[model samples]
Target chain A: MDAALTLLSFGPDGWGDDIATGVLVTVGLALATLPFGLVLGFFVALMKQSEEPSMRLAGNIYTTIFRGLPELLTLFLIFYGAQLGLQQITALFGEETTIEINAFAAGMVALGIMFSSYASEVFLAAFRVIPRGQYEGAYAVGLSHTRTMRLVILPQLIRVALPGLGNLWLILLKDTALVSVIGLSDILRQTGVAARVTKEPFLFFGLACLLYLVLAVLSSFVFSAIERWAAKSGGTR
Target chain B: MNAVAADLVERPPTPSRRWTGTRIAGTILVALWALAIAGLALYLVQSWNPELFDRYAGRYWSGLIVTLQLVFLSIILGAVLSIPIAWGRMTKRRIPSALAYAYVYFFRGTPLIAQTFLIYYGLGSFRPQLEAVGLWSFFRDAWNCALFAFTLNTAAYQAEILRGALESVGRGQWEGAASLGLSRLHTLRLIIVPQALIVALRPYGNEIILMIKGSAIVAIITVYDLMGETRRAYSRSFDFQTYLYAALIYLAIVETLRNVIEWIERRLTRHLKR
Candidate 1:
């Protein structure tokens, strides 16, 4: 009991810093992925919404392929496959390439790409909810497609997509732990290391779990705020 | 939520019929663009080594089997456990409901990898305490530990699915059964569970697919599931393309399961068909 307590203590001997740093890395990588995913998702959504047949097909294939692949496989592909592809590129350029893609970059690329696929679906469905009349009204006023999209469609799209996006963010936050497999010093990896060094798996892991719970609770409040904002904005519009 | 969904569903169809020759050409153009990406990927793999298939063929098959087994066992156990958990959550008493809610929150809040490690390594650390209770034998094995965590995690989600389905069952049905002098248990067993099963079936199928993908985490805990096998195979041969091939196998399983889920959903909702 004393040992378990000591392991969880906030002192230098404790695993607090290590585990906390892991949580930081996990959150950082997840946040980095968010914007990239949203952009990719926007394109996919636009492709999905396109009147052009070929654009829809391209979008469909993109979503289908990524959505169908397991998250782990996607991670491995981006991590190792990207590494190998880069090496070959450098070789062709006659440059000695030793610039390794670390676990963080790989995690971002993989999760960002995967998250975008799900986001596209959310955005697509959200767009579908807007009545055609709204789009027609924008067009009737001689609004250019780009201007109409900028002013009318994007705001409504964000409102409709906010709930689903909230869910996706929660999912991405939790899934950051998977990057630990590729050796990102994330919370799970840090906990594992601490567990191994201290030989007290329960104490460190239990702490890690608590930290994750706290993270979840904190973000849930953030999501609720976003939800309220979206709801209010939705009403005013 | 249901009201919004109902309104959306009741919305009349758009009178846009832009499907034309130009649209067909556009579709082909987009398809070709995607094919170009796929083609590039294929070219890279093929150029890297044409014999990559033969190099890791055997290992990929075995990995595929392990992934299927992992998915099947966890989901089956999860489905079985969901009933009691959902029942506990739905009960009138505060304790059971709170306990059920806590279970859901804890499992849902953490990552699957965290839960997997917590069970595999964390429980193993308690070998002595576990042995005192004669559960050490089970805890010693990675497979058992992985299954325990997966099942518990999935059960939490499944319980929520079941709870929603049960709540959505109309009060009219239960009252109607009561009018026939049926006991509560009888009414629930005959009417409630069957209806809930229909509503829960599709979500359950989605959970099963999620479980299939989730089982890959066990590879980190020293379970030789698909990912584990692929790592081993690649480490031995240094053939990276083989890993790509392994990914395709996972993709195949996902596609097949998706079709299976769709078919099951269609079958279950047959009554609503026009």
Candidate 2:
């Protein structure tokens, strides 16, 4: 029975294909959501820095609502609510079609939103850590605000932000499991389905943990390499 | 508008230059969000079928009670258990410290879902041996098994947080206490642990919020917590809106807990001048 659970056999027979598919999806979801999160986080961080009463207020509200809400709740809210809203919008066009949002997209949106809130704080903290002298030096060089940010602030921000970004990546990788609830065929979901079908919950779950352990270990190695590379670049450009 | 008021009271403005586009965008965004929230509230009120609520309210209530009980108990047990784990890590020993590190690394490395499954299902594999050892009775109940998993997992993370807090107490401070001829235990209990607790309090509060959310994962087991109940409702009714309702309940619980955490952090740290 244990030998039958090997990865290569057909579905409902061996977990090989399922485990492989789950890992790919998990990695895919994590990689896809990361950039979207960074972009959203950048805007939020900028908003957090806004001097205007309203801009700061909006930024604060965005972070507060998302941060206060559980990752699972946000996933459900956007998953169902977004679908319903899309359906309503289609109805206005007289199509009257029920459009379904894919579970992967919904999961990405939810994870992206959550990660953006946290990454914004990381960016904000990085922004604060930039030496005031650098900005003044950029000003002395007659660099415009945008150029100054790109040339001076960003390079330093990335350096200070590397450790945090690494931490965020690890977190996002783990959180990809939340997609299991939305019915995505990720590792956890695959394990769950296998558990239900095979009635061998222990085998599937044990395998799932081993799979995650592999991913976590593999990711730490990647992050450590990045950390070393970042350090070797001599602090800041 | 009211939400803005709530937000502002919690986070006072740090002085910065006001930008016009930022203001316009900010106000529009906030207004849009407020409108969306108000709309959701109205939809819930208008579309709420009292019969449906009455029918499922029992399960929801039962689930809610279970959820709270599970979270509260795991945290209490996790808190008590974490101290020794943390102490073992901090003490100048090789083997115990190594074991402590391994425990934290393994648990923290994996997802809580994996941890719970591994505990409940993985342990169930050794049912005969467990029974022989007289431990199967404790592990047989889904709730007990889930509680044990959560407790161990939380203790690992908490141990790290506590260890960091303890290490942050300056070397001089430890020496100062030692010079006063205080015993090692006295220095730790009276000086080191108290100060560390004060520092650990905020992070620990955050952990509590984390555990509240984490408790939802126990639903995968036969134990019916809030999320489990939500899943059951959705499966039965096939209405995704039931999930939204569940999410809102979760959001409210998290928001209220977050506010409490912030209030406590501020109250505790008030002595440190900003």
Q: What is the interface RMSD of each candidate, in Å?
A: 2.4, 2.1
Q: Chain B TM-score in candidate 2, rounded to 2 decimals?
A: 0.88
Model 1: which residue pairs collide? A53-B27, A54-B26, A54-B27, A54-B30
| Candidate 1 chain B lowest-lDDT run of ten | B44-53
Candidate 1: how close is chain B to the reference, as a TM-score? Answer: 0.83
Query: lDDT tens digits, residues B58-117, model 1?
Result: 766777787787778878888789888898888989998888889999998988888877
- Encode model 2's per-residue lDDT on A41-153: one tens digit a residue: 98899889866767777888888878877677678778877888898898888888877899999999999999999999999999888878998999998999889989888
Model 1, A156-175: lDDT tens digits are 98988988998888889988
Predicted structure with the largest TM-score when compared to the true one: 1
DockQ of 1: 0.57
| DockQ score of each predicted structure, in the order shown | 0.57, 0.53
